[model samples]
Target: MEQPKRLSRLKTTALPTSLSDHAAAFDRLHPQVQRWVRAQGWSQLREVQTRAITAIGGHRRDVLIAATTAAGKTEAAFLPLLGAAAARQDRGVAILYVAPLKALINDQHKRLEGLCADLEIGLTRWHGDAPQGPKTRLLKSPEGVVLITPESIEAMFVRRPASVEALFGRLDAIVIDELHAFLQGPRGLHLWSLLHRIDAISHSRARRIGLSATLGDKQHAAEWLAGEGPQPEIIAVDGGGAPLKLQVRAVVEPPETSPPTADLEARSALAEIARHAHEILRGKNNLFFAGSRANVEALADRLRTLSEDGGVPNEFFPHHGSLAKELREEVEARLKEDRLPTTAVATTTLELGIDIGSVHSVAQLGAPRSLASLRQRLGRSGRREGSAAIFRGYIREPYLAADADPLDRLHLPVAQSVAALHLLAERFVEPPSGDPALLSVTVHQLLSRIAERGAQRADQLYRAIGRDGPFAAIEPGDFADLLRGLGGGEEPMLEQAPDGSLMLGPLGERLTASRDFYANFKTDEEWRLVNQGRALGTLPIVNALAVGSILSFAGRRWRAVAIDDPAKVVEVVAHRAGRIPKFDRVSGEPIHDRLAGAIRDALVASDMPAYLDPVAAQLLAEGRDMFAALDLARTPLIAAGKDTHLMTWRGSVANGLFAVLLGSVGFECETFDVGVTLLGTPSDEAAHVLGALDGCPPIETLGRFVSNLAHEKYDDYIPEDLLRRFWVKRHAHLETDVADMIRRIALALS
Candidate 1:
C-alpha cells in the first residue's frame, strides 16, 4: 500500500519583538489579576490574550475570539473584562456569560471560581440545578458575573420579568461561549432575540464577546455576534501547527438476507469495532464518538463487558442527553480527575469544551455529521505539547453481493469518510446553513416579549422580533398575518385590548404559565427509567417496550419488570442479555453540497487516500469500480431494472426538492444521499421528464408531495399557508438551488 499524504503544516505567526509591548499588555490587567498571573508562574501572555486585552480593555470593543481548544480563550476574554469590572463601582451584574449547555456553564463556573474569588467579584450560577441561595442573594443584590444558559434566560423573562431590569440593566459585557453552536438553528435565533431583548432592557451598552474554536465563516459569525451593533473585532489564531495523524478502518458485514440476519450482521460489526477499540484505547484516556444515544449505550456496554471479561476494572462509560444527570456527571468527573484511564463513549454531548483533562486521541464510529463536527471532535485531543492530533475512524460498509442495491454497492459511507478526511486536510469547513425564516422561534419570542412587557403593540412586537431582530427574513405582510393568526385563531394565543395592545389570551396564559414553555426547541415525551427507586435515565416514549422486554442503558443491561403508564416510569432490574433501545432522534445531519461533491470526486479520482487501511482501500476501489461500470460520471440518470436513479450529486435538501418535484409531476420517487430514485420509471422516460423541466414548480404544488410539515415546536399553531411558507423556505431552496439543479439535470439528460 502507498503511504498516506500528510497534511501541510500551517505557518506560525511571528510574535512581537519589543518587550515593552508585552509589558504594556500585562500592565493593562488589574493589579490583583497581574498578581494572580504571576502566582501561576506564567512568563508572558499568549498572542490571543494580548490582542484581546488591547481590543477589549483599551478600546472597549465587542470582540470575537477564535482559537484552538484549550488555548486560554476563556482567560483571554475574562481577564480584561474582569479588570474593567473591578474598576467599576456599579452594583448590577457586570458580566453575563451565556453558554449553550448547562454542563458547559457548570464547567466554567468551576474553572472561573478561583479567579473571581481572588478578585472579590461575586460569581453566581443561574440554571436549573444551581442552588437557590446564591440566586436569591444575587436577585437581592445583583452584582459581578452570572453564568447561565439560554433556557434560564427565557425562564427569567417569563417568570421574573419585573426583576430582569434590576439583574442585567447595568451589565458590562455578554460573553457567549461556543458561539458557533448558536449560529444557525432555532436555538441560535432564540438566543439572538434574547440578546436583543437584553440590550433593550439594559441601560448600559454591553459589549458582546463570542468565543469558539470552530468558525468556518468568521465574517458571518462576527455579524451574528454584533447584531445591530458595531462589527466585533475578530481575533482568530490558527492552531500552533499541530500535525494531524489520521487513519480510516473499514468493517464489512455480510449481505442482508432477511431482517434477522441484518440484525446479526449489525451486532457482528459492532462487536468487531469494540474489539479493536478495546485493544487500542483501553489503557489511555480518550473519547469515542458513537454518533447517537443508542450507539453510545451499545458501544459503552460492549466495552464494559469486554473489561469484565478481561478481569480488569471498568473504565468505559456512556454520556448523552437521555442519561440521568448524576450518571453523566460521574462520567465527566472520572474523565477530569484522570485517576485512572477512562474512555467515554458519547454523543455530541462531550464534543464541546468541558475541561475534561487532555486525552490521548479521538475515535469516531462512523462518518461525522459534518466537517465542522469532525474538526470540533478532533480538537479534544493533541492538547499536550509535542503530540500530534490523533483520529481513528471506523466505517462499516455492507458486503457487495450481486443482488445488492446500487446505493449499497457504492459504499457511500466509506466514500464520505475519505472525502471528509481530504477536506480536513485541505482546511475546508462547511458554512452554517439554517432556516432564515424560523417562524417557530419567532412565535416563541413573540409570546416571550408579550409576557415580558405585560402587553405590546403589533408594530412594537414586529419590530422587536422581526424587523430589527434575528428573524429578519420575515416581511411586514407576513408579520401581520402571523399576528392575526395568533390574535384571532380558534385557539387564540393573543388578545387585543381597546388600547390596541396584544396581551396573552386564555391559551397563551396557560402556555406561558407552564415551566415547559421556556424552551424554543421541541422535545419528545419521555418515560423515566428507574432502578430500585433510583433514577437511571429517560427513554423516549416512542420506544415501545413491554414488561418482558430487555434493553441496554447507562452502560448496563436491564429487564423492564413493570412500566407505570400513568406515571411515565419504567421499573427495571439488572439483566445479562439485552438489545439496544431506539430513541426518537435522527442520527445524521444534512450533508453539505461541498461534501457531496467531494464524495463524488473521491469516487472518480484514481489516486487513493494514503490514510485508508487495506480493507478501506479495497472498499474505495469497489466503489470507484461501480461508479465507472454504471457510467455515473457521464450522466446523472441511470436505469437499473424497472427503476431509474437520478444522481444529482447535490446535498440532501436539493435532492429532497428534486424528489418532491418528481412526485408532483405524477412520478413515484424516493431520495437517498446523492440522488432521487424514480420508481418503476424507465431511464428514457425519466430523461424526457428531466429535459422538459423548466424551473421549480409552484410551492403549493410541491407542498402536496411533502410530509412532516409541522416539524417545529410552534408550527402547529401557525396558519397553514404560513406554515407551508416556512417549510418551503427552510427545506427547499426552490427558486435558486433547486432551479439550478433542475437545469443541470436537464443538460445532462439532453
Candidate 2:
C-alpha cells in the first residue's frame, strides 16, 4: 500500500502559523470538503476549528482541542480528520471516535450523519444499543469512521480479538470526546491500556485528537491524551461565548423540632426550593441540576405537582441514570426539538455534551459540585448569539439553631456555592487527580489481554499491562506479588502452564465469559422496575421494599405491587404520594483545597457578592457573623458542646486523613467537610495531640486505621496487602496536603 497523496502533501507542507494563513489550511482540505463547508454557509472557521485544521491537516502529531460547549469542537476535529480519511488509499476504519457515554455517541452519530453522507464515508456506531447489522457490515468491510465507547472497545478485544488488526490496522486518527471524563478513574486507565494494546496489535501510528469543554490544565490534559506518544499540539480557545448572568438563592430549612420531625422539615425545605425553581424556570428551555438521582426525583415530582396545582402544562421531567433509555431519550428529544418548553431536572448524566439544543438557562438546585462542572453546565446555555449565559444557584442552609454544629453554623453549602461562583468568574477550574496505581483496572486489562491472546508469559503481561503500560506506577516486586496472589490462591484467576506461560484459571475464564468483564467500574446490583408491563428503568437494591411502600421515581409516585427476587424485578403501579427511593450512588465530587479555602474566605470577607439574592445575602451575613463570633480565623480548634472541632480549612481528603490520625491515637473522631470532629475529646487534648505531630504517619501505620479498602470492582480479588496499598495510594495525601495540614494545625495550636 502507498501513502495517501493528501498525507504526503501534509508531511511536506509548512503548517500555517497565523490567522492570515487559515484560508490556506482550509484550501488544503479535500475539494468536496471545502464545497460542503461553503454549503453550510459558515463565513469563517472558529479559532478552534482553524487551529485544528492547521495542526491536524498539516502533521501527524496528536492534537487536543480545548473549548467550551457548542464551540464546534466536533466539526473542528472531524473536518480535518475526515479529510484525511476521505483521501486514504487503503480500506479499513480510517477514523475512530471514542466517547465516555453511549448517549454522546448517539448524539454525535446524528450530528455527523449528513456530513458523513455527503463525504460518502461510512459512519458506524458500535455500542450496546447499536444494531447488529451495521456492526456486522463494518466487520466484513471495515472502512470510514467508527463511533464507540471505551467499554465497547474492551468488548472488542475480548470478543473479537482476531478482527482488531483488520479493523484498525489502517486507522489514521483516533478522537476522544469529553477528554476530561477519561482523565481520572478506572475507566480512564482501562481506555489507556486499550489504546496501547490496539497500537501493539495494529502498529498503526494513529494521530490522537481530544475534544473537551472544561480543562483546568491544558498541558496535563494533553499529556493524558498523547500518553507515551509525541506531545500533542494544544489548541485552547479562551472565553466561553456570551456574558454570564448568575444569581444565588437561599432556602432556609425550618429549625429541627425533634428527631422525628427532621425528615418532615427536610421535605418542606425541598418543597420550597422546588417552588422557587418552578416560579423562575417555568415555561422555559432550561436544565435544573439536582445533584443526585434522589434529588432529581424529589425536585421533579414537586415541580410537576406545582404545575398541576397551578393548572399549567407539566414541563418538568427527571433525567438520571436510572430512568429508562426511552424516557431519557424522549426528554432529550423534546429539549432538542424546542417545540415545547422543557426543563430536565437531572443529575450529572446531563452534564456531558449530548446536544440537548439551546438551553435558555441552567438552574443548579444545590451547591455546585466544582467550578469545572459549573462552567460546563453553564456552557449549555447562551449558544444563541447575543444571549447571556444564565445561571441560578439554589442553596439550602440550616436554620442555625443554638444546638447546631459549628460546621452548619458556618453555612458551608451557601459559602461553597458563592466561592464556586467567584471562581467561575475568575475562570478557575480544578485539575483532575487520581491514583496512578489503579491496580483494579490493571487486573481488568490483565484478564482482557489473557483472554485476547489465549496465553501469555508473566513478563510479557507486565510489559503489556504494567511496566510499559497504563499502570506504570506498579513496581516489579509489587506486580509479582499481585500475580502470585492471583495464581497461587485456591480459587486462582490465573494458572501457569509447564512452559511458564500464564492462562486463565477457572475463575478467570468464568469471569471473562460474562458481559460484565468489559467494564472496570463498579455498578450496583439493580432491580428492573416495571409499571403496567412497561419497563421504567432500574433501581439499585439498596433496601427491601414492602408491597404497600410508595416510591418516588421517574418523576412520578408508584406503589409497589410485586417483587421478583430471582429475576431482580420490581412491579409498581401509580400512586398518589411517595417518598424518594434510595439509590446507591455517591453524590458529589471531592472538594478541592482551593475551593475549600475559597469557601473559608467567602465566610470571613465583608464584601458581599452582587449575585446573591436577599435570602442568600442574609445567609451569608449570618455566616459571617458566626465566623466573627467564633473568631475562627485565629481559633483553629473550638469546643462545641462535648466535641472539639478542628477547623482545618482543607479539602475532604486532608480532613479525612486528620480524622483517621486522631482515631489512630485513641481519640474518637469523624470528618466533616472542612474539619475533623474529635468526639468527646477536650479542645486542649486535641490541640496537644495535633501540636506534637512531626510528620504524616507511615503508610503502613495509617493502613491499620482504614477500612472498606475495596472501592473498585476487582479490588476484592486483589490480595489484602496490595488492596491496602491501592487504597492508601488513592485516598491518602500523606506527603503533601496531609503533611501541610498537620503542620498548619500544629502551628495554629502552638
Candidate 3:
C-alpha cells in the first residue's frame, strides 16, 4: 500500500491551527492506545509524540525521531507503529524492532509487554540469550512486533531465509533503536546491508523509523536512515528537563603531609574513595561508570569490603559484558525494584536505555571516551520528575616522580574531564559521522548474501552490495579487485563453476561454519566459562588462565577445575578470595577531534572550571604552567628526553596517517595519546624529515608501511592494492592540508 498522498505536505507544510488539532491526531490512534495512555496517567503527549502522530499517522512518511533519553523516544516511534499494526492483517510479523544490544531489546520487550498485552499484539524477542520457545513460536506464527539485534537478523537470514521472507512479506515498519550506534563502522554497514537484503527478499517497502537520543548530525542521520528512499521526515524534538548538576574532583594517591609508598598510597586512595562513596552514595540508587571492567571489579570489590567492615549490606555490583546473563539480569531486576539502595559499577554495558528505574546520580571514574558517551551516561540519571541530572566525575591520577614528564605529572585527567563537562554544559555533542567506506562490513555482507542465495551474478551482486548498497563510496574497480582476490587466491573463498555461477569454495564453507560469522562487530578470542557443566559466561583468552586457576568473575570467585579444548569451555567451581583475573573490555569509540581540541584548549586557558575540586583546580593550574613553559600552542612538537613528540591536536585517524608518513620517510613513529612519537629518531631528525616533505607525499604512498590492513573479518581476502585504497579512504584524512603540519614541526626545531 502506498503512503498517504499528503505525506510530502508533512515536510514543507504549516503547523496545525490549535491544540485541538494535536489532540485530534492523538485521538485518531486506536482506542486501546488512548486507554493505555490514560492508564499511565500522562496528561498530554510529549513534543516527539505529537510530531510522530502528525508525521506518521497523518502524513504516513518514514520518520526519524531525534530526542533526548527518557523523552519517550521509544513510545514516539512505537505508538504510530503499533497503531498502524492494529489495522493491518496479522499474518506474518508486522513490525521489526532492531536494537544494538540484546539487553536493550529484552528491556524494551518487558517494558512494552503491558501495552502489547493490552492491545493483544503478539510480541516476541529473539537474541542470543532469549529462549528458543519465542523464536520457534514466532517462526510458527510470525505476527506483531519482533524485537531483535542486528546479529540475530543476520542469523535469521542465514538459518531461515524462506521463513524470513514469509514473515516479513507484509512488514509494516522497521523500528531501529539507538540508531546513532549504527550510523558508522562495520555494525552500521552490516545493519544497512541487512535492511537492504530484507527489502530484496521480502519485496516489502516497510517504512523505516529510527529512534535515537544523540545524533551529531541530523542531516547525515536522515540520509543514513533513508538510503535510496525519500529522506525520512526528521522530527527533532527538544525536551525541556531539569538542569544538569556536574562536579569534577581529583584524588591524589597520598596525602601531601606524609608521602607513602606507591602501593600503600594506591590502597589509601581506594579506601578514601570507598569512604567518600559511603558518605555521598550509600543508601541511594546510583551508578558508577569505571574506565574498564577490571576497574569496575576492583572498585566494586573494595566497596563490598568497606560495607562488610562497616557492618552494612553490600549494595555494589559489577556489570559488564563478560558476566553471566543470569547475574546481569539479577542486577537489572534489583535496580528496577528500587527498594534496596544499589549501585552498579559498570562499563558501557549499562549506558544504553534498559529502564532500570531512576538513578539518583551517575558517577564516572575517569573522563568519558567521547562527548556523545558522556551525554548518554548523564542521561542515565535525573530521569525522574523535578530531579536535576547529577554527574560526579572522579579523576584519579597517581603521583609521578618530580622529574617525570610535566605533561604526565600535572594530572591532566581531571582537567580533561572538566573540559568535557564544559562542552556538555554547552550542549555540544559529537555528531555521528555517516560517511566511511566500510569494506569490512561489505565483505561480511557479500559472504552472507551469497550464502543466503546460492549463486549471485557479478552484476547483480555489485548493484545490490555496492552501487545501491551502503558502500556506495566504494569504487567498482576496487570491488572487482576484491572479488578476483577472494576467488583467484590459492585458498580461494569462492569458486566460479562452469555456468559462470560463483559459489563458496572449501575455504568459504569452513569460514561460514564458525559461530562467529554472524556478527560484524570485532571481538576477541573468548573461552566459555562453565560451572559444573553449566555455562556461566565467557572470558577472553588473553586473560591467561590454566586448569586449576582461581579467579574472580560475575562478582564471585571460582576455581578453574578443567579446560576443555575442543568444547572451548572452562569448567569452574566456587572458591573464596580468588585472584582477580586479567580481563579486557573492548575500547569505546575513538575520540573525536573536537573533544581532543577542547582538552588542548583547557590546558592553555586561564579560567578555572567551576566544576573542579581544589585538587583538580591545583592540577589544572600546574598543567597550564607546564604548557606555558613548553609553549606548545605555537609549537606542538617537543623533545621529551630522547623521544620527540609531535602533538597533533587531531583525531586518531589523522594522527595515524601522520605516523605512517613519518615511518615511510625512515623516522619510525608510533601513535601516543594526542600525538605521534618518533620511536628512535631525534627531534632534529624528525624536523628534517618534516621539512623535506614540504610538498607532502600522497597518503596512498605510505600504505606500504601501514601494517594490519586486515582488521576486519574478510579483510584478508581483499587484494593488497584495494585494501590500501580502502584504508586510505576510510582512515587517512588526506582531505586535510598537510602544509600547516609541516610548518609547525620545522618552526619547533628552529
Candidate 4:
C-alpha cells in the first residue's frame, strides 16, 4: 500500500510495547497535562485505558471502548491513537471524531486539547457552532484530529465534498463518542451513511473505535456504530467508577379544595421543593433535571423564593433549549464560578456532555425515561473525590385514591431500571435496539448522494438507496412509490429543479440546511410563554395554542393572558393551579418485559413490599384496605369510590382501548385518565367491547376516516401510512396482553 508522503515514518513504539511503554509516553506528557492530572491526584489509568492500550498496541483492527461515564473513555480512545497517528506520519484529519451532541464535541475538545500539546495532535470540533477558520484549515490541510457532530458530518459530505475527501483520505481511525444516542434515530442513519461516503471517497478503510458506557444495548449498538461494511472489534471496560446513591420518593400534594389549577400545585410543590432543596443545597452544586421547560422555570422561580426568604443570594438557575443562549450560558457560568451553592433546574439541554462544575446530587421530577438517562444523570455527580450521585425522584400524586391500580404501586420500576444502569460500576450495561423508522436518515443520505452526483435516473437512485443504502430491505413497491414522490413535484421542504437534478426542495432545504433537522432528539417545537418578551417559560405547541382555555401548567395557572397566534405563542400570568396537568412527555416508556413479568411473578410469589416512606406507607395501607374492601384488583369491573372505578388487571393503554370501544357498544362511557367512566348509566352489555376489540378495526371500517393522523414529526416524512397501521395494530397487542394478564388475575382470584 502506497502511503501519503507527508510522513513521520515514526515507530508506534508506544503501542507495540507493553502498557509500561504507553505509561512511559504518559510520563513525558506536556508539563501542563501532568500537572493537571496530579492536581486531581495522580491515579492510575482507568481500566478502559489499560485494555485500550493493549488493543491499540497490537494494532487491533477495531476497538469499542465501553465504560461508565467519567471513566476516561476519551483518554482510552485517543491515547492509543496518538501512537498510530505518529507512526502514519501523514496528517489529514488523521482521526474523525463523531459524537451525538455538538456540545459533547466541544467538551471533548476542551478536555483533550491539553493532552494533544504533548503529541502536537491538533484537535478541533466542527458543528453548527464551530467557526469557519478551523474547518477551512482542515480543507486546506487535513492534518491532525478533528471532532464533529453527526449532523456536521452529514453536512460535510453534502456541502464540503472535496474537503472531506482530502481530509479523510489519510484517516487512521474514526472515534464515535456517546455511541448509544445515535444507534436508533435518523441521526444514526445519517451517521452511518456519512461513514459509508467516507469509505467511498477515501477508498482506504479506516480503523474504528467506539466510546460509550451508559449504552443500553451494546451488541446491536456496536453493529450500528460499526456501519454496514468493514466490521470493527469491540472493547468494553467495566468502568469501575464510583458508586451512586439513588432513591425515589413520592411527593403527594394535598388535593385542591377547589377547581384544579396548575399554578396552585406548582406553588404548593415549589414550597416543599424549596425546603428540601435548601437542605441538599448545603452541599456541592446540584442539578435538577426537569422533563420540560415550564417545570424548569417554575422550579427555578420557587427555589429563588427560598433564597429570598432565607436572605441568601439567588442560587437557583434555569436552563432549557428555548432560553436565549446568553441566559443559558450565564447560568452555566455562574455554577462554574462557584458563585454560590447553586443549582440549575434544566431540561434535556443539561442532559448532554456539557461540562459544568461537578455536583453533589441530581433530582428528577418524574421517571428518568430511559436507562441511559439514569446513567447520565448519575454521572453528573461523583465527578470529584468521595462524591456520589445522589438522586431523588419525586412523583406528585392527587393523594393516592382509595383504589389505585396495583401497577400504580409499581411506579418505582423505572427507578429500578435506573439503578441497574448505575450498577455499571460493576461492569454491566444494556445495548439499545435499532429503531426501524430511520427513514428520515434515508432521505438525508439520498439527498447527499444526489448533490454529489447531480441527477440520477430513477432506477439508479433506487438501486443506490435500496441495494446499498440502509433501506436495503425496503419493499420494492414502497421504494418505487417513494421515488415517484421525489422525482419532481412541489415539495414543501425541497425546492426541485425542472430536470430533476434534486436540489434541496423547499422542505428539504429547510430541513437539511438548518441545524435543527440534524437533531434526532424528538423535542417538540415550542415557544416561550413570554409576558412582554420576558419568557414566563415555554410551553408545548398544543398548550400554547389553547389560549383563554382554563389549564394548569407548571403547577400554576393563569388565563392564557394572550396568544401570539401567528408565532404560536401563549403568555400566562402566573396564577394558582391547585393540581397541575401531568405533561404527556412522549418518550416511550421503557417497559422491561422481564421486569414487568417479574413484577407479576413477584405479586404471586410473596407479599410486595410497601415501597413508600412512612407517611405514604400509611396511605398505602389504607389503599390496600380500600382495594380489599372493593376487591378491585381481581375484578374486571367495580364501582368503588364515589366517582372512581377500579380496573387493576388492565394496563393504562388497555384501559384506554376498553373505554373507547365501550363507547361504541352503546355505553354512555368516556375514558378517564386512569379508568373508564360512564357518563350516565352503564349496561352489562358494555363488557362485549372487550372481545370486539380483539380483532382489527376491519380495514374498511368507516367513520369518515383519514390516513396518516400521526403525531411524531418523522411520522409524516417517511410517508409510511400503511406501516403506521402496522405499528398501531402491533401496539394494540399490548392491550391484548394486558387483557390476558387481567384474565389470569380474575380467574386466579375468583
- In order, what lDDT does every prediction score? 0.80, 0.80, 0.74, 0.58
> How do the residues 1-750 of candidate 3 rate in per-residue lDDT, one tens digit apiece?
454535633434335335776687688788888899889998888777887887888665578888888888888878877877887865889999999988888889987889888888989988888898988888898898899999989988887877888788778889999998888778888889888878786655888999988777776777788877876788887675657887877776653444546667446656667667767898888989886778889889888888998898989999998999889888888888999899999988888878788889999887766888888888788888899899888877665565555447435576568668778877777775534337767777778878888888777788888887457777788778878888976778888879887788877877777789999877644568888768888765422233444445686667666766435577878764333212111123466677767778888888997878888899888888877887787776676566676778765556656665665566544454467666445667666776666645776666655544454556656776787777666544553445466666676656
TM-score of each: 0.88, 0.88, 0.86, 0.76
What are the runs in model 4 whose C-alpha is more than 4 Å off?
1-43, 239-241, 258-267, 334-339, 400-437, 468-470, 488-522, 525-612, 620-633, 636-686, 691-750
In terms of TM-score, how similar is model 3 to the real structure? 0.86
Question: What residue runs in model 1 are displaced by over 4 Å at the alpha carbon?
Answer: 1-20, 255-267, 434-437, 524-588, 698-701, 730-734
Show how many residue pairs clash in every candidate, following the order shown: 1, 0, 1, 36
Question: Considering lDDT, which of the candidate structures 1 and 3 is the better prediction for this target?
Answer: 1
Using lDDT as the measure, name the better of candidate 1 and candidate 2. 1
Candidate 3 RMSD to the correct structure: 8.4
Q: Compared with the true structure, what per-residue lDDT tens digits does model 1 show for residues 287-333? A: 99998788999899989999999999988999988999999998888
In candidate 3, which residue ranges exceed 4 Å CA deviation?
1-18, 255-268, 432-437, 489-491, 524-589, 679-692, 747-750
Residues 615-668 of candidate 4 have per-residue lDDT tens digits of 434434444554455544455454422222324332234444444344344443
* Candidate 2 lDDT for residue 53: 89
Model 3 accuracy (lDDT, Cα): 0.74
lDDT sort, best first: 1, 2, 3, 4
